[model samples]
Target: MHHWRIDDARQTLVLAATGERLPQVVYWGPALPAQENLATLHATHAIDVTGGMLDANPDLSLCPEATRSFPGQPGLIVRDGEGTPLLPKFCYDSESNGNDLRLIYRDAANGLTLTFIFALDPDTHIITAQTVLDADAPVHLHWLAAPVLPAPQHSGEMIDFSGRWCGEFQTNRTAWSAGMRYRENRTGRTGHEHFPGLIIPCTGATNTQGEAYGFHYGWSGGHRMIAEELQDGRRQIQWGHAARMETEAATQFKTAPLYITYSPSGLNGCATAFQRHLRDRIITWPKPDAPRPVHYNCWEAIYFDHNVPALKDIATRAADLGAERFVLDDGWFGQRDDDTRSLSDWTVDPRKYPDGLHPLIDHVHGLGMTFGIWFEPEMINPDSDIHRAHPDWALGGEDQTLGRQQKALNMALPAVRDFLYDRMSAILREHPIDYIKWDHNRVLPMPDAAQTRGSYALIDRLRADFPQVEIESCASGGGRVDFGILQRTQRVWLSDSNDALERLRIQHNAALFLPLSVTGSHVGPRYCHTSGRMHDITFRAWVAAQRHMGFEMDPRELTDKEATVLRHVTAWWKANRDWMQRADILRLDSADPAVIAEQQLAADGARFVVFAGKADTSAQIAPRPLRLTALDPNAQYLISLANQQDIHHLSRGTPALKSGPVTLTGRYLMANGITLPWSFPDRMWVLEGKKL
Candidate 1:
């Protein structure tokens, strides 16, 4: 028997080959002893398809199937040239290179070959799998998945997310059931409605208790994630790029890798694994150690009113409030006063800046802040010059549906990709622009593989040419949040909505899989333009400070008191952002449903910060004690309020701070917890703790 098992630091993946069939995962969970073999496990754990099977070995009961079964979705689907399903038998051969594993299977009838690639990050306990197909003869490919694995047992609760526009990354949980639960996004881009990941926690598991497993689809385009429980109590979770092909040459194609990890320590354990994998392997930060700049965007300030004098005034005021980057949003190019026209033109609007953006750029630089600009390079307005010149470049044709009055460019076309790359590259060469807020406001009407590949190619080309230019991925906000895009861009605008209260839930859920350093959080105006909710400036700033801090308000309208609060928040962020960047994030469980608590513990066990906010509190005067986590039990810590001044008039007898810089042992803090001040709705508090 030819079998293999790969062991990461915490888990083990066991694969076995039985005769001519492709190898299947027999076990994936907490590591077994080093001397354990797959034969013993398979004899005891493999599904028994003895006499009750129609196909002898029932396909539905198999661990991984090449085609769909009654129990779950197929991991691979392909058809032939004449529109017939190509169900081929497997011919297996295996090999290994370093720590990576490769298993080859051939279909002699269809002249096609499939290879399953597997690798594990020894440190993070992340298992990666990818599927590749090769064919010598003409074959029409339908759909191909990365890889699929089945759970040993069907006892757990499924956790996922759903949201829209300004309200993204809303968490949802459901008990494991027999029927299939599928979440899919066909919006061309990863829509804000659903995330491309799933978490399955063992029955009755808490944030830090029991066992949990995470499955993340690495593709950034349209995707499908499914969790199904079979009649026999076994569960299967599968994910892959959601692409359809009627009849195309199947010479070679590879599905994006799907990442899987198991955590005995529950949700927080899974989160830590994902964060480490992203920061260490996925995101390529320009300055990983340096703090992200506090940006002040001009979109809300003077939308489409792009004049040099007005922008200069805003920039000056933003700098006075410690904004290190000033971004000029939409309406700066070719007749782009509104969303209707001039998207792909990529030229500075002469009417807005007669001197070709130089005066505004210089003014921003003179204010000691980096200059940034916004662009929707992959979209074209029908009224713009680019569309007029290349009407056929639009995806789904010009006659199809339009979003935000704009159509997506056919990124798969070499001509279109080159055009976008050249035009965006030219802008970088022409000016001292330090950042690019790449926004994709529309979704693709059809799932064209070219669009995703092409968009990625264009961004890659631009980044390779201008290494200093930082890019933010904004697909109508939180629409393109994934490891694939994060690989090319520095940060993501978590959502378009700047309502602080809404942002708390959005940021909290997103931070589960993404590092706060790569999430773009902004302090919007007092009256949120999206939600129309008015929040205090201090409340807004405190929430934004938890991530890559920025501001999306007009500084010219700020009151003197508001300006002082903004300045203090920015100063405090600059002083503590280093710890926030590298800390291990932990979302604490609260007995009260109204309160959300999050903690960031420094890697060295020296410091940590906790952010507690309430959307709505009960009538009870005293809130439950907030237990802190991820601290060294032996060490002592000194605690203080991040915002010492009672900006919101917090109750005087708050348990978090009863005296000046109260000191407590980490063991006590983790076990006993602390109480928070009673305040009105939408109130937040930040507590900082330093090892003593």
Candidate 2:
């Protein structure tokens, strides 16, 4: 028997193999003593045989083999060049060292080699794993999962996500069953409907307590996830690209990295690990030491109306309101007056700016704000010049249904990719552009792995050439957000709906996986364009401040009072952004169902800010005390309500929090919780606390 173990401060993972067979992860959980025997643990991990089963249980190795009669879904599915299915049984070959483990397996008869890579980040406590397959000759890949991991037996339910265009990250909790809980996103992008994340919580786990396991597939393309429970009561999870997404035969195939972590400190532990890993390890920032600038995107303000004087005026007002970056969203290219035409035409509109984009770019620069331009590179409209010139560049059938009046470009074609690169690179090279609001407004006609790889190639090439520029992934809003895209881009436009009420809920749920630093939340027009809901400037500004603060509404329409409120909020956000950007967003469990609250605890445990948003009226008349997390029990904290001036007339009661700053022990704050004055629906209370 052979055994290996990987350990960090928070968790442990042990793998074992018998004879020459591939290894199976025998044990994984909270950290054990360094001197513990892994071999004995592996031996103790075995299960007994029963009727209707084989005399001896087959090891559910890293890549479960059909030849071994494994009951659940096989990890790898492939075919030969002539389309004959091939079941390659891999055997132990070799291993590597260091912080990462590379386990090599070989199938001599099939001329195939398999390698599973595992790396655990000591700082963030995230385990990153991937599987690579190599063959002597071309083979078609149907499905190839990352290193498979076992699910917790004590967990009763799992939480996945399902959402729409504006409503992203809505959590769906389902009970564990005898079979599989399968989910597949085939939109050809990391879809809005099915976010590539799963959280399995132990029976009584909450946001701030209990043990939980989190899994996220980092691929931006279509992906399939399986959380299965065998008849033997063992559970396993597998993540891979959508089945048969590979179009042509190939000699090599690789699964995207699967990021998993065991959270002893509940769901927030998983969230913080992912958050730190993404912001610190995945993203390559252009300006590392620079603070996150406040963004002002002119999409809702003036869609497709690119008048130079009007834009210059808006830029000036936005800068005056504390915006440091100005993004020129869509409608600057081709003859694009509307969404229907001119998607692939990457040139500046002559009618909108006859002197090209220089006049507007120069004006934005004069306003003391960096300039960003928007592009939909992976899509082309039927009325576009590029489509007219090369109809074959479009993906799928000619009669396939269109989304947002646009068809996806055949990114798999080098000719198509070269054309897009030439056009977009010319703009980036010529202009003093520092940012690109990269948008994918439509889904591909079909799910093809080649299309995603080609898109990734284009972005990678662009990033390498213009290393100073930042890119944001916005797929009609929240459609293409994942670790794969963030690996290249700096930020994500969280959603299209800027209604503070809706945003309060969406952002709360999304915090389970995303951090505040990479999430873009904007203060929309008083009348939200998508939802038609009107919110106060106070509520809007505070909600936007929860993430990468920005504004999408027209500055010209802001009332004097509203402008003052926005300015103060923006200033406050800037004052604390350095620490808040690195803070762990801990979701507070509010006794009142109507309140959605969270606490952003600084990395050093010195200070924290709690945003308690009253999303709706409470079922009970009085407000419930909200609890905070991750604080020293004996330490004393001075707490004060930051937005007390925004209190309404109805909130006349003199709650201790509203009266003045109060000092309380962390034990009391976590147990008795903080009480607040009653507020109306769609309102929010901000509390700032510091440890003494």
Candidate 3:
């Protein structure tokens, strides 16, 4: 079952059973426990945050303010929330004097969907409650029923782990996220041992010490994901990871958690934690239509202002070199370089190509290839033809409407959203275009589009508009990446940070519950982003190969050696697409920067391994016993590899892998580990194995 074992400290829960359909969703969280002490909690009134009765009650605490609450009514409100109304569920005033919180879950029963509300209180150590009906129509309730974080005041003060934790944001290049923190017993008497839900917010409250923070990092951007925060002296707590009642698609959410020193003693607990339950279903996008293998991009070659011929040349070279789709990154449509004009025009620049975009599409298609184009349609240039034609289309700002690139669309506006729908749909329908790299460049600096009239209606229109389109969400690089979006699209561009080793951390965190298919991991060049780490192209590709593998560099620019290696890698992913695209991944040395991820598909499953030797101090690696990840225990796998040398293998498999009762690890041949060319670039190979 894809349910959570919240009662267990280890949180044992299955994500998906083999042969399960993709885009599978599973709910986790301990079933509501019987309340030993149930009592009536009351508040005079609840503020409507969905712009319905939207207003700032300076009297009450607001978001980014830990103690403030975005009060919801006694019942839930779920109107086919397109994007505004934020979300169906919201935090209401819990009796802890608004400082305390109670969580509520609302489901329309139409889809068995759920919404959350977080009301947090720091004073009496008392967290209160609510829940809305799971009936048809809008659904709302108290956002949080149980205290995700125990009231700090009631708990012993021997050690307060609750404080703002800081770390790098997995997506945006220029930001850091911080949230409240609190520590729980390693093993608690209740089901949860370490903690129920640990949150580190970007914006929240602080003391006169000027240390209290707010969950404003991503918020100031476009506020796609909502978070609330506050501080209690050195100890802080936050309510982040909030979804707008009006939300995007479901996805592998990179709940970018932060870890900081509470008392300068350094991190006192395990760096890992889980709040959500595993989704039983896997999400699958159709394999690359043209590449035959999952495609990659070379935008690294041309960020924007990509010259037509240059791009054409890149596409031709990539296709010849066995590459699939050559994605044209930002700068084709609007007056992009400086963000000036023509966003509503969705046309190929006449100057860039006298022949128009059709020629390029034709050229790529002519080469037995597919063409992909990128667009930040959600945004508008302050000086674009669209804005000029209809100024009202842009979200009107009183103080100043937030704009990413000159101007931003009031996605909350029906006409504006319809304009987008018509423009993009018409473009794709008219052109020979096979793929659309739909990107949301920046979070609305003023995410109050919902503040406008009919904003949610506009969002509904957009959702209905782009079903056939293969859109990839990019909140400035993976910030908007999530399961909500996944339901509509095939994959997510994991993180904008192209650090290969950093990817290990991200992919690990993501795959902890997400399926292997939804991840879009690309093999990029060395100049990308190196956090003082050693990264060989081989290592990068190997790490990426585990997911939906693709490349980000222009093949024409590749060194002779690099090109040769990439060609082989491309062929490998193609030949072993069956295994690479679908398999339970096994990593031999996950902790080491260098990792070897092997996958064994169904017996009829393809077998492949992504070898990234990031941690290679020596040229030689001792191969040891290798344990299979998703192979049948009793099934015999005839692994065919090795130089006939002293290739020391890995020592052993996880004890679970060795257990016969566990089908995933049992039948598969358990070899120690396989060693590869430590010096040579990484490799993706299709190993022929037989089921015992």
Give the number of the best model, judged by TM-score.
Answer: 2
Q: Per-residue CA lDDT of candidate 2, range 1-692, in tens?
A: 88888889999999999888889999888998998888789888999998889888877878888888889999999888899999888888999977689999999999899999999999999999999999999999999989988899999999999999999888999999999999999989999999999999998999999999999999899999999999898998999999989988889999999999999989989999989999999999999899999999999899988798999999999999999999999999899999999998999889998999998889889888999999999999999998999999899898899999999998889998899899999999889999999999888888999999999999999999999999999998999999999999999988888989989988988888888889999999999878978998999999999999999999999999999999999999999999999998999888998999999999999999999999888998788788889999999999999998987888878888888899999999999899988899898999999999
lDDT tens readout by residue for model 3, 1-692: 11111123211111111111111112112222433111211122222334444264312111111222333211122333243333332222112223322222222333323222222222111112222233343333222111122112222222111111111122221112234222222110101111122222212211101111112111112211222132311122332222332232331112212111111101111111110111122123344442334565756777765587787787877786676666777777655564455666677666676776777778778777777778776666666777778877765463464445455566655677677777777777777665667665544443331432232343335446544445555545554443334444555665666667666656654442244555677877666643544455555665666667777765665777767666666665577665444354433323334443434343244343433333334343532334444445555444543211212234233333222222222332443333232233232323345444
Candidate 3: stretches off by over 4 Å? 1-293, 296-298, 339-345, 396-407, 446-468, 529-535, 586-635, 640-692
Which residues of candidate 1, in runs, are more than 4 Å off?
A: 48-63, 66-71, 152-154, 243-247, 647-656
Model 2 TM? 0.99
RMSD of 2: 1.0
Better of 1 and 3 by TM-score: 1
Ranking by lDDT: 2, 1, 3
- Per-model CA lDDT versus the true structure: 0.81, 0.92, 0.41
Ranked by lDDT, the better of candidates 1 and 2 is: 2
Q: How many angstroms is residue 570 displaced in model 3 relative to the true structure, after the best TM-score fit?
A: 0.6
User: 56-170, model 1: which lDDT tens digit per residue?
Assistant: 3433322256442344566666667666887666576556667688887877777878888888998877888888888776666556767767754745578898888888888
Where model 2 places Cα greater than 4 Å from the true spot, the runs are none
